[model samples]
Each structure stands twice: as structure tokens, then as C-alpha cells.
Target: MTAASRQMKLGAFLWATGHHIAAWRHPKAYVTAGIDIDHYIQLARTAEAAKFDMVFCEDAAGLREANVAIASQTSRSIGFEPISLLSALAVQTSRIGLVSTASTSYNEPYGLARTFLSLDHLSGGRAGWNLVTSASPIEAANFGSTGLRPHADRYERAREFAEVVTGLWRGNPDGAPGHDGQSFSVRDPLDLPRSPQGAPVLVQAGASDVGRDLAARTADVVFTAAQTFEEAKAFYDDLKGRLAAYGREPDDIKIMPGVAPVVAETAAQAQEKYEELQELIPDDVGVALLSSYLSIADLWRYPIDGPLPELPPSEGMQSRQALVIEQSRRDNLSIRQLARHFAGARGHWRIVGTAAEIADELQARFEGGAADGFNVMPSFFPGELDAFATLVVPELQRRGLFRKDYEGRTLRDHLGLKRPM
Candidate 1:
């Protein structure tokens, strides 16, 4: 496909609080992201009009960790439950795919498989599952544990967790197969008929070794925390290469890295807005959250206006560390600056500039083959998302880097991924 016809896939990476930490503080962000059905409908309507691919929602089973103080005063928590919300969204959006988060750690495979199948059927094949292993410390406590399984153990269970799920999704000429496995097993056929897209497209969000294994073995789409062109490119190449070891074709899976875009009429204006957003970041919560994300001690100990200390080596979380270090470097960010910056997009690429400039960067990533598209976390919400779907999307379409119309309805169709049998 040529650049215009190539149709880079796009999806919303929604959090109830909106992507920006202070988003709910914006004058226009709907107060009800916690449960506003109409607000979500508006997003879907706007995205579909842009001919974008899908809308996604992430989930957390635990009370949000950042809700401790001022951030709690914000919309840090809100949204109808994922499956229910998406089910509601499905009726409102005819073309945009619906992808909802479900935890492999918390849910049984047969039930999740059945739920997505039902969502697919309900939405006319527009459903997808964003599988998460539920790694956050807050998430562990929700499940009755004071701490989470070690990273290695989580992915280990995830491997078999996925194997059984995928096995159950297999439609023998007879029906859904029962492949008994170590971590999980199933014996009965799913009574629900195969969805129109077969099964809902499977997606995985972890980028650790175990995360990589599950995605390579079972998911049709994989998401990562890559925030720079280099980091994204490396991840793309690694994943494409690993597909062969999984005995899967490189093209069989689609890669989407998260990007946080802050658009303006000029580079300076975008930067100014970026700065203002950071300044608005509430201090105590932002500081505590920053420390929490990095597993560090009181980061505020460093001078607020001075340089960041060097990041230490880390495993099972290289991508996250790289994002933090490089962003602080690129922006020459101070402790205060870094704190607010994270509020905007949580360390994703913060593309700021005119429409053409934003388009240029997005197009470069697409051309470089680092991403099939993106999980766009708009710097703010409603307005920011509206700006993206309205202004930036049209510019991309005019340049032929994005689709003018969706040719397929399901998330699988949007990603050029095949439905599982």
C-alpha cells in the first residue's frame, strides 16, 4: 500500500482520568469519565468520523495508587466497568473497534474467552481483548495479597494462562477445543457460536520476557511502552524477529507503541502549553507517584530545578526506565518538570508542534516500520482527543498517512489481523 492507502491503524488508550494526569482539571473534560456513557459515545463518534481503527480502555482491579491526595481530587478514577462500558460503546459506534482490558491473573480463560466472544457477537465483530497480567502492587492487594507475584512468576502463569485460552478458542470442525495445560485447563466447548470475526482479537501489554512469550505465542497484537523512535524501532525489530521463533509470521502480529502528542500552531506554543500543563501538576501526589513508578526513594530530595540523578540499571522494566531517563534528558527536565511531564502522558512520546509537525513525526514512525500505528493517549481529554480526531487526523488523511475510511469493522480487520478459529 502507498502512504495514503497504507492505512496506519489508530486506537485510543483511554484512562478514566483521561491520559493527562491533570486532564480532568481541564475546563472541558467531562466530569463523568468515571461513568459518562455520552462522553465515550462522543469519543467513538469523533474517532469513527476520522476513519480511525479502534477505541481501547485499560483496567485496574485495585484502588488507584495515585488517588492518595490531590490527584484524587482530580478525575484519576472514573468509567463504567470495561466490559459493560465497551458493550455500551459498541452500540454507539458502528465502525470503531472496541478493545477492553481483562487480566489473565484475575480471570479464568474460558470465561474471558466466552466474554469476548459475546462482546464480538454483541458488537458485530468489533471487539478485542487487551490482556494484562495485572502486575501493579495496588492490583495485588485487590486480589487479597499484600504483594504481587514476582515478575517471573506472573509471566509464567501467563504463558499457560494464554495457552489454555488460545486452545479453548480453537474451533475444531467439532467446536472449541479443550487443551489441558499446567496453569489452566478446560474441557467443554464454548456454547456461544463463533463470533462474526471468529474470536475477539487478542492483545497483550506486558513487554517483559514472559510478556513477549505470551504475545508471540498467542496474541494478534502487542503493545509496548516504547517512547522514542530508537526505542520503538528496536522493540519492533525484536518482536518481528521473535515471531519466527514462535513459528509465527512477522506480519501476523501488529505492533503499537503508545504516543503522547501535544499539538499547537507553533512549536513554541506547544512547548509553552506542555510547560503549563506540567506546572499545573499537583506536587505531593505527582512526587509520590513518580517515586512509585521508578521504585525509587523520595525523588524530591533532588533539587527541583536542577538535573536529574542518573537512573540505575533495571531489568523486567528496561523500556520504562529508558523513557524516564531520555525524557528528562531531552527536555532538560528538572524534578518538578519531570513530575508534571509524567502527568501528561506517563512518559510516552510528547510530540508537540503544528499539525504538519505532528504529522511528520507520526509519518516518520510509520515509514520507519517501528509501528503499524499507535495507541494515542491524548495529552488531555475530550478537547485534546477532539483536537486529535478533528485537526491532526485530517492532516494525516490529507497526507495519505492515515485512512479516510475504515474498510473493516472488527479490531482484527483494523489491524489486518486474522480472527482466531
Candidate 2:
């Protein structure tokens, strides 16, 4: 597509309550959002009505926080399993794509491949999978593993897992000799037919060096986090640059960084709205969140007002750990300050502005080659999503930066992705 015709893709990243740690406390936020299928149905319909490319759900096998007290303080402890949730939504919403996170760490390839293909057919090709190597020790413990696998080992397993899943989705015949690998073994092809869209769109969010390589090899869409234009651009260029080696073109993969926008009619209102939520965050909750991202324990033991202590490499999310440390050092922020800042959007880029201002920043990133699109993360559910759909989406449409209407039925058609041969 030509530059002028290259409209940006948007995913409505639907998290429980909201992306903000303190979102459940917001008077307008839906406190029961995690269990309310009706709430998710409403959220999905809202995104579809706004012409978003998809409604994305993130999943974890276990509770997010190990500390029972900390876990109880947040709404994250309760939520529908993403696959079942998306399946119910498949029948509820007609056009928007339904994408959900699933981990290679805990699931087998054939079952996962079969499950997503079922969702694809159920949605009439409007399905996608965001692949992740489960990074949390809490998740590991739930699966009865001795401990968390090293990061490299997890990715190695993921690489093979993805290969098998894609192979099955691409029509590996039922009686064929199947995969025999280091981490898994498969005896037969999936019982289902090929996905209605050729295959369910493969999405990945790992941004480490190995992660980038994995994405280049397999992902049709990449969801990432970047706090700056420079960071986004560099990641975009590097990942796109790797396509050649994989015998794929740059256009084959869509790189969408996560963007959290707190938008209102006026800048002051937006800022006020943001600060209101930030003020609701208990310091301990924020610190626990920061500690999880850092892959460290007892971050609370440090002086909340003091500088971050030096750290070793993380066996968790390496890219996110680096991002946190970089921000802590770059801004000379104390633990309390950094935790509060990151707690709002969990380290994704945040924009507190009027509709037009938010559009300008998103336009800059898209037009400047820093991103192909964005995964829109609203601070709170319903209210914040409603605000963006009403205020920002129209502004984007008016500027011709986003689609005014759906051009086709399937997610692949909306994304202009090539069908598998």
C-alpha cells in the first residue's frame, strides 16, 4: 500500500477492569468486569462499532501476584479464560477480530492449534493468537514445574511449538508422521480443517533479541511496548530488517506497539482524569507490580524513596526489565515515583491529552515508520473505551489516519495480510 493509502491498524486491548492498577477503584470503572461476559461483549461491540481491527485479550494460567494480599487488592485475580471468553464473543460480535494470549510454556501444540482453528471457524476467520512463553513463576508453580524454565529454554520451546502449530494450521494431513522435538511430541495432524482465513493470524509480543528473531520467523503481527519514538522506530527497523533473512518481506509482519491513552475533550480534563486514577494506587500495590516486571522479589524491602538497586539479568521478561531499569535511571526516579508512573500503563507509552493531541502523537509514530499500528490500551473499561471510540477514533477518521468503516468481513481482510498458500 502507498503511504497515503496505508491506514493504521488498531487493536482494542481488553484487560480486566482496565490497564491501570487502580482501575477497579474508579467509580466509573466496572468492578465486576473480569467475570462479566456481558461486559466483554459490550467492550467488543464498542471496538467493532469504532472500526477497530480487533479486540485482544491477555491471559495467564494463574493469579498474577503471589502475595495473596497484593493479589486481592487488584481485579486481575478474576477473569474468564481468554479462549472461552473469545468463543462466546465470537457469536456476539460480527466483524471485529478476536485475539487471545496463550502460552507455549503450558500448552501442547496440537491442542492449541485445534483450539484456535475452532475459534477461527467460529468467528468466520476473525481470529488471531498472541503467542507467549509464560514468564511468571506463579504460572510455573501452578503447572507443577520444579521452577521457572530459563528464558532461553522457554523461547526454544516456543520456537518449536509455533512451528508445529503453524504446520498443523497450514494443513498437515491427519495421518502424517508428526513432530518429535526436544520439548514435545505429536502423533497426528489436527482433526480440524484449515482455518477459514487460510490460518489464524500468528501474533507475538517478545522483543528481546531472540524474541525478535522468533517473530521474524513466524509472527504475522507483533504487539510490543515502547515508551519513546526512538525505541519504537529502532525495534520496527530491526525486526523489519530481519525479514529478508527469513525469506519474508517487511510487509508480512505488522508491528503494533501498545499505546495507553487517557483522552478527553480538553487536555486539562484528560490530565485530571489520569491523576485521579494514579492517586488511587496504593504504594504497596504499585511496588508489587514493579517487582513482578523486574523479576525480583522484596523490592518493597528497598527504600521507596531511594534509587533502584542494581540488578542482574531477568529470567522473566527481559525486554520489559530493561525498559524499567532504563526509565528508572534516565529520569532519576525513585522507586515510589517509578512504580506510580509505570503502574498507570505498565510501561507502555501513555498520552494524556485531548482527542486531537492523541491523534497527532499516533500519527507521528505511524507516519514516521515507528509503528505500523497500535494496540489501544485504555486506563479503565467502558468509560475510557467509550471516550476513545467517541472522541479519538472520529478525530483519527477525520484526518484519514484510520478507517472510517470496515472494508471486509474477516480480520485478514481488514489487515490486508496475505493468505497462506
- The lDDT leader among the candidates is 2
Hey, what RMSD does candidate 1 come out at? Answer: 2.5
For 369-410, candidate 2 gives per-residue lDDT tens digits of: 999999999999999999999999999999999999998888
Displacement of the residue 32 alpha carbon in candidate 1, Å? 2.6
Please give the TM-score that candidate 2 achieves against the real structure: 0.99
* Model 1 alpha-carbon drift over 4 Å, by segment: 1-5, 174-176, 296-318, 326-333
Candidate of highest TM-score: 2
In candidate 2, stretches whose alpha carbon ends up further than 4 angstroms from where it belongs are 173-177
- lDDT of every predicted structure (CA atoms): 0.76, 0.94
lDDT of 1 by residue, 259-326 (tens): 88888777898788777666666776676566666756567787777777876764334446566877
Considering summed lDDT, which 10 consecutive residues are worst modelled in model 1?
A: 313-322
Listed in order, each prediction's TM-score against the native is 0.92, 0.99
Error of 2 at 55 (Å): 0.5
